[model samples]
Target: MKNIFDKKITNEIIKRIDTLTPETQANWGKMSVSQMFAHCCVTYEMIYTEKHPKPNGFVKMMLKLFVKNKVVSESSYPKNGRTAPQFIISDEREFGTEKKRLVDYIIKTQELGEQYFDGKESHSFGKLSSTEWNNSFYKHLDHHLTQFGV
Candidate 1:
């Protein structure tokens, strides 16, 4: 897996994002380009903002037990795979606004670097290593960016 904390890789991801436009069509899935951007932002939102409510004790335990590996591992997500409820962006979004937010989040994460995130408490999965954080961030963005054929 590529290290998202690396400047070069981060720039590459940003470049891929720059290619997206409002009318960009998904290669698969039901999300519009704008919705995809907003959906992608949910990951960072969970980390950097208190926008989404944290899962309760049982749900958190379930997520850590059953979902953590699938998320933090290097494996690419299956196309149109199930999205967590917090990540579902059913309503429309402004393409530029969402895209900028995603890009800003990526830049901020990269800027903070791995050390800042080492042993950080994740919103759902409790504490994780820097590697787990990188994998989760990069993999999700890559999946959705690829979905839009970027």
Candidate 2:
């Protein structure tokens, strides 16, 4: 997995994001380009803000057990795989707005660096090592950006 904390990798990811446009269509999945941007932002939102509710204890445990491995692993996601409810974006979104937010969040995560996330508590998964955090963050963005053919 690529290191999200590395400045070069972060800039490369931003370049991929910059290639997207309002009219970009997914190679699979139901999301519009803007909705995909919002969906990608959900991960960062969970990390940096209190906008989304943390899962209850039982739910968190289930996620950690059943979902954590897949999310934090180095494997690529299957096309149009099931997503968490929090990540579903059914409504319309402003393309430029969501794109900017996603870019900003990526920059913030990179700036914070690996040490800051060494044992960070995730929204759904429990505390994770920096490698796990980097894998989760980079993989998701890579998956979606690739989905839109960027």
Candidate 3:
């Protein structure tokens, strides 16, 4: 998996994000480009803000048991995978606002670097290693950006 803390990879990812606009349509999923951007931002929002509640112990246990591997592994996500309730963006979002939020999150994450996240607690999976964090961040962004043919 690519290191999300690396500047070069983050720049490339940002470049991919720059390719999107309000009119961009998904090649597969139902979300508009702006909704997709908002959806992508939800992960970072969970990480850096208190917007979403942390999963309860039972849900955390279930996530670690069943969802952690797929999320934090190097493997790519399957197309049309089910989204968590917190990640479903139903209302329309301004494209510029969502994109800027996402880019800022990426920059903040990269600035913090891998060591800063080495043993950080995740909302659903408890503490994760830096590499696991990188996989989850990079892979999810890649999946959604690619979904829009960016």
Best by lDDT: 2
lDDT, each prediction: 0.94, 0.94, 0.93
lDDT of 3: 0.93
The residue pairs that clash in candidate 2, if any, are: none
Return the TM-score for each candidate structure.
0.98, 0.98, 0.98
lDDT of 1 by residue, 96-148 (tens): 89988989999999999999999999999999999999999999999999998
Q: Which runs in model 1 stand beyond 4 Å of their true positions? A: none
The clash numbers for all candidates, in the given order, read 0, 0, 0
Evaluated at residue 123, the lDDT of candidate 3 is 91
- Tens-digit lDDT track of model 2 for 28-130: 9999999999999999999989999999999999999999999999999999899999999999999999999999999999999999999999999989999
Tell me how candidate 2 scores on lDDT.
0.94
User: What TM-score does model 3 achieve against the real structure?
Assistant: 0.98
